[model samples]
Target: MKRLLVLSLSLLALCAAAALASAPASLLTPDLALERLQRGNERFVSGKMIHPNQDAFRRTTTAKEGQKPFATILGCADSRVPLEVVFDTGVGDLFVVRVAGNVTYFDQAGTIEYGAEHLGANLLVVLGHTRCGAVTAVVKGDHVEGNIPALVANIVPPVEKVKSENPGMDAAALTNKAIEANTWQSIEDLYKQSPIMREMVKAGKVKVVGAIYDVDSGKVNWLGEHPKQQELLALTGGAK
Candidate 1:
């Protein structure tokens, strides 16, 4: 009986150690999580995909257990901008939210909050891209003349604000500016509008970031590290 007890205790200790080792380092700092993402993106842009999801057997095993995606991406419904390919992330690595123009309504905000507060996601990324048709429509004041008007209406306010602030800015510039503004607005909405996300941010449990993907170059410009509010404002117009 004494030998059996010793063996059981030893087995339990080994299991605990293995669990601690397997737990990701991002659980401690959001910066570490960001670093991981940057590295993955770099690999993607360099034509060196890590192919983290290729192991079907391992994926099935993990599926049977559970998932713990590290980051959540709120992005546009554009077919050209695929979240996983651009970021070089695998199936279980990211929780993604997609909508036309990347607009966040009450339900979308709740979904993002759940990813962070309940799904154990440590970071949130609002990703926008250039040459966006939705933004173009809003800039040109071209509502689709149907139920799509509501969607266009949601994207118009930020472009209008940008034009009002910089009266001399042209249509193309305004649309480009609004695409970023809309992205930052989504970032703000994720934090200011969602109670659960706000609490997580306040407690340092999660970090909210903004980014823009240049469709021409396939490069991801991280907005979180922008040095000044003016620069960020110039970039996204949600600088304050």
Candidate 2:
């Protein structure tokens, strides 16, 4: 029994070492990483997905060396919004953090900073989708039980803002508007709340952008245009 246990331990150690030896090297720049995802999404919608980098070899390499995902996605925990399938990315391509409504408070901000600083991810995406249950629950003011109320409460501000801004708008439009606002609000909160993320964006080491996924169409609608290197540098006051 003792000999068998020793052999098992030795094999486990060897596997760990081999995995470490095959880890990925370097990462794409923020803009390029975003473009790669964009292309992947386009391919997905167009029915031309190549399903790149999802093979067993890629999995083994990531498990061994560690992950160096180029883009970090802060997305909703909604089941239909599968980040990998939507972007058509494989293992170690994306560092994803999920929460209801995609809101960033203390813990979520810390998680984003981990992807940026620790994992060396250059792109951060706050991805929200249409018909999200969390946001809808807030809009409806449904009495949820347990800790869920606290989670849904974070979305109320945006919903209220939408109500105030568009008093006559119907419920559907209001929810949609609020969803966009909530997504951007989370992006801004990350800047205001986390010094690491703020500094990284200022230093041009990271780019944070907001996007919306249409569940009906399988399309990602970025709130603004894609990041231009010149514009980004100018916006950051030439921090890089």
Candidate 3:
């Protein structure tokens, strides 16, 4: 019993030292961080991911030291779309904030800013997905009449705007458009509504971007450039 306890303590101490030594020297730059995520997604799409951190040792090491996630992803609450798996990231690679419609309310925005400002994360991604139930609910004109309504309410304006723009579009097309619009709107909200995020953006400390994940292809289509504020407002109609 004494020998087993001594060996366990010794192993734990060695693991702690190894984890510290393996910590990244500095936070990845925004562009580099984006590239890493893209590469990981590509691996995911190809079904060729190495899945480096699945070992018990890796999990134990991660628990011992704090995470140093490179990117913060505000993704949907949809079960089909998980940020870590889509990005091929291990336990500590992403700081994720999930909600229906991927909307950025005050609390969500504050959480994202906290990750960037304090966690040394350099990239913020608003990730939406195809066939998102939240977007579909808004497009189908479904309402919950209570607190759930508040959640659906955030998604309605964009769905309505897209409906107005493309009168002849089918339900599938409308849902896709609304999904993209919602993602872009969330990105805009983060930039304009949060002072901390704005300062981080202006100083190049963090980059806020939007992407839509394809459920079928497992690919992420990153919105290359941010749209103008007027264009975004027109799409969302300044939905509160």
> What lDDT does each candidate get?
0.74, 0.80, 0.79
The candidate that achieves the highest lDDT relative to the unseen native structure:
2
Candidate 1 global CA lDDT score: 0.74
- Provide the lowest-lDDT 10-residue window in model 1: 231-240
User: Which model, 1 or 3, shows the larger TM-score?
Assistant: 3
Task: Give a tens-digit lDDT track for model 1, residues 39-122.
Answer: 667767878655565378648956896667788888888998888888766667788999878877776788887888777888
Model 2: lDDT of residue 45: 89
Q: Which residue runs of candidate 3 sit more than 4 Å off their true CA positions?
A: 1-27, 229-240
lDDT order of candidates, top first: 2, 3, 1
Expressed as tens digits, the lDDT of each residue in 1-240 for candidate 2 is 999999999788656433332334263567767777787788788886667677898889889989888889999999999999899787888899999999988889989889999989888989999998888888878889998887776688878888898988888988899998888777766665676776788788988888999999999998752334233333332112
In model 1, how large is the Cα lDDT of residue 174?
A: 80
Instruction: Kindly report which residue pairs in candidate 3 clash with one another.
Output: none
- All-Cα superposition RMSD per candidate: 10.7, 12.2, 9.7
TM-score of each: 0.79, 0.82, 0.82
Off by over 4 Å in 1: 1-28, 225-240
